[model samples]
Target chain A: MQKLGDFKLPQFFNYPPYFTLQPVRETREKQVQLWKELILEYCRTQKIFVIGLEEEFPLFSNPEIERSLSHEAREAFVSALVSDGRAEWLDKGHRKCLILWHRIQDWAEIIINFVKENGLEDSVMTVEEIRSGIESRGTELHGLDRIILMRALKLLEHKGKLAIFKGTTADDEGVKFSI
Target chain B: MKEQLATFRSQLEEFARKHRNDIRKNPAFRSQFHEMCAKVGVDPLASNKGLWAELLGIGDFYYELGVQIVEICLATRPHNGGLINLQELCNLLRQKRKHDREAVSEDDCLRAISKLKVMGSGFEVITAGKKKLVRSVPTELKKDHNEILELAQAQGFVAVDEVERRLSWTLGRAIDALDTLLDEGLAMIDDGHEDGKRRYWFPCVSSISSVGADS
Candidate 1:
């Protein structure tokens, strides 16, 4: 019943054993699955894309229970996510991770839907416009990470569904949708 | 009338004089003879003729209880020839000394042997084992060893070494103590089945009713 920023946490999130990496295989597998779901759910709802091991992550620690996942447990859960292709290590040290609540393909589909719904099938827009434009308001695309949005745009571009071009300004990038 | 009383007194005095010498030789016989003389109002010093007969009869039952106690102690340790050994008896004496240290004495084996014989119920004295032979009461020793052996048997198939370890004694001492009981025919040693190990047990002791589980 615990809520963080409109996301309802599962009952097991408060379980102390959830913080400790279980030694038994079956129990650990279940623990890792639960962690994967929670991490994806929290990141998707809160628009949280990056998780730094050194930095405080709300899901990793429970101040009420005075229990925090150790560094090993954090790596294990994140590694499980990476193995499942839902998250990736941002650095070789794995100190930071980029959670992909929506995989690049899924993101591309969302972009296609957004463009079609807005009646802008042939129109061009900057990468930033797709993230925070009025048309994208109240949608999952709003305030999304630029890097993730760019990655999703590049995937669509590679598939010939859209074309990406550099804008005149240093910060802006343009995207052209074909369909 | 005075002459008749005088004649009767002389006859009783003659009987006392005849047995007096034999009675004096055996204190028990002398006491019985003295009592009989007193009943007939005879003078013991005056009668010396039937003294040996009177002494033998009294001596027969004098230590009858003592003999029975020795018999029970012998039954307890049957290995010993109706005599309880010093070392095994010392162990019992040691136990007794704990509660009453004053009970300790070199003469305890002899006294305990005599005490059991006097009690006269299911006991005997026996000399136990070829070496360190001494007097012991088997029935009492059975009761004593039963308390300790029951505890050892509770472990189920206790190793010979384990018994030695728990008693805080070396293998030799444990075997020596056990051998005393064996000489009494209360315990047996089984060997040669496998690995050449000897297991000691009391077939009659019945401390543990279940056997196959340990085997």
Candidate 2:
């Protein structure tokens, strides 16, 4: 029931060894998997689109035990995520990471459902509207990461579900749903 | 004297035939019967050809129990990194077979372990202090390793300072043993502490189970 800003942390977060990278092969494999699942779940619920390796991520530290992951440990964990395709390093030095908590195809499904529910199946709406408009408010789409949304939209476009075009203003960059 | 011995042997055979069901179904009775058979230099579970074997079918019984033992060992191997206490294993086995009529004794569990044909040098029962540990992995643990594991039985972990102070050993010896255990995946390290003392924890010897939704 430990809380990291309303996100319930797993019990192992309090374990000191969990903060350190395990040297044993089997133990390290299990530890890496737990970190991957925790990172993904945390980002999904907290709506965190990116993780900075050098920045203060709540899950990486436990104040009760005064334990924090070393820089190498943090990089190792995020590297595991990168290998799994659940996350990506945004830079060559591997500083910042883009968290893809949901797969691109899944985000596309959510967008299609939103279109159907809002009666915008054949309508044209700005890309910004899909992210910030009142129509998308109170849904997962609200305040969604621009990069992930754009990727999902591009995936939908390639599948012939939608089309992208320019408008009068950058804010009005339009996505036309032909569904 | 030979006639008296024949009388006693026939009596034992008769007794086994009458309580054959009880001997198989009850752990206490099974252990007592096993002791009696051992005392008389007769092993009903030794082979499947004789009258004692035909009457008790004890060979097959131990064989079936061995399969269940192997099943529990394999399933919980990850929990303790393939090393577990013998008593804990028996408790888990009994819990697993709660619906069955046959209650297993520790002696029966030992017999079951011996009965398993698949167990080669990789599997063995080793003594750690007063307790017996069932090791499913092939890792060869030294006496120093066992001593560390025994010391860790209380708190689930041992700091190097603690190991040094308690065992009256040099710091280098303690570190060498702990490092070997670490390399074997039998011990996990925790360098995070208030005083910055590095610790080595053994899940196999530690009684405190890790509590989490998905451990």
Candidate 3:
């Protein structure tokens, strides 16, 4: 059980083949699936929103085994996640990836629940407050990515459950919840 | 003469039936039985409906083995370039038939491969120095190539200088033959030597014992 900053790694992470991209079709598919699950689980637990390909991501390498995923393998696993709608490439070069462990719809639902629980329905709050506000403390919504927070807010606004308008400050935005 | 022939045929049939299990179990005994049949001007593997085929089913056995040998060769051709070690071929065949009771040996694989030679598709067992390699392609080995392969039998590899000195051939001729062998996958190149001379290794002809001794 290798721990990556309090995130417990699975046993198969030490398997050598898991580092190298398998050439065989069936074996590669299973390896990619395992990597996709591990990456998503790691990101969700650590509240990691984006992964830069060129950066040294801890999940991509194992120092004890001296094994690391090649750039091609990293791209392959990330691409698999993108195809399944669990992740999205933020750039054409695929250098950055935004992982969506919870789909946009699910994120919207979580926002609605947080608003109702905090009695913030029909109340106004800055978009940044939903991410770092005292009401969202200790919840998954706390310290969430501003990009994802805005997307979830837009989804809620489209359904007439909330309204997003420019705030008094240029960089700040406000979200008004009707639920 | 007719009476003697009838008696000999009956005797062979009786011998074959008594040692049917030996033929299947012991490769050396099976080859000796084949030799005896050859000595009598009899072909045991001539047809599946023949006397020996009826008594021991050896003909059909080799036929089935021949099909399997082809499959293994073709399956591994991309990796080894149709030149596979005889022992490796047998190992693969055994693995393929692991659930079956019949055990395949190197001798059995050689026999089955020999049967495949009649098809004229270039299936052959060529000895390089001390290694036995199965060549499934129809590429004709020239005299120069044979000589080089023979020279490689001693040290498991041959350098251009050694080939030139021993065979009294020009550098171009030695390179041409070695290059052909390399292209055919019959030899491997080793450029790791400090002397800056390339050593062409024929895996088929190199004896494992000599390699161990060198190491």
Highest-TM-score candidate: 2
**Candidate 2 CA-lDDT value:** 0.82
Q: Least accurate stretch of 10 residues (summed lDDT) in model 2 chain B?
A: B206-215
State how far residue B35 of model 1 sits from its true place (Å). 83
lDDT tens digits, residue span A95-142, model 3: 999999998889999998998898888999998888998999999999
Q: Where does model 2 exceed 4 Å of error?
A: A1-15, A41-58, A61-67, A90-96, A109-144, A166-173, B1-25, B42-65, B75-79, B91-107, B117-121, B208-215
Regions of model 3 farther than 4 Å from truth: A1-179, B153-156, B192-194, B203-215
Candidate 3 or 1, higher DockQ: 3
**Docking band of candidate 3:** incorrect
| Steric clash count of candidate 2 | 0
Best by the lDDT measure? 2
Q: What lDDT tens digits, residue by residue, belong to model 2 across residues A42-101?
A: 999989998999998888889997889889988999999888778878899999998888
Candidate structures ordered by DockQ, highest first: 2, 3, 1
TM-score of chain B of 2: 0.85
Candidate 2 chain A minimal-lDDT segment of 10 residues = A10-19
Give one digit per residue, the lDDT tens place, for model 1 in A53-148: 889999988776566788998999999999998998989999999899988789889999999999999999999899998999999999988888
Give each candidate's interface RMSD in Å.
27.9, 2.2, 12.8
Please give the CA lDDT of all the candidate structures.
Answer: 0.61, 0.82, 0.79
User: What is the clash count for each candidate, in the order shown?
Assistant: 50, 0, 6
- Candidate 1's displacement at residue B81, Å, is 67
TM-score ranking, high to low: 2, 3, 1
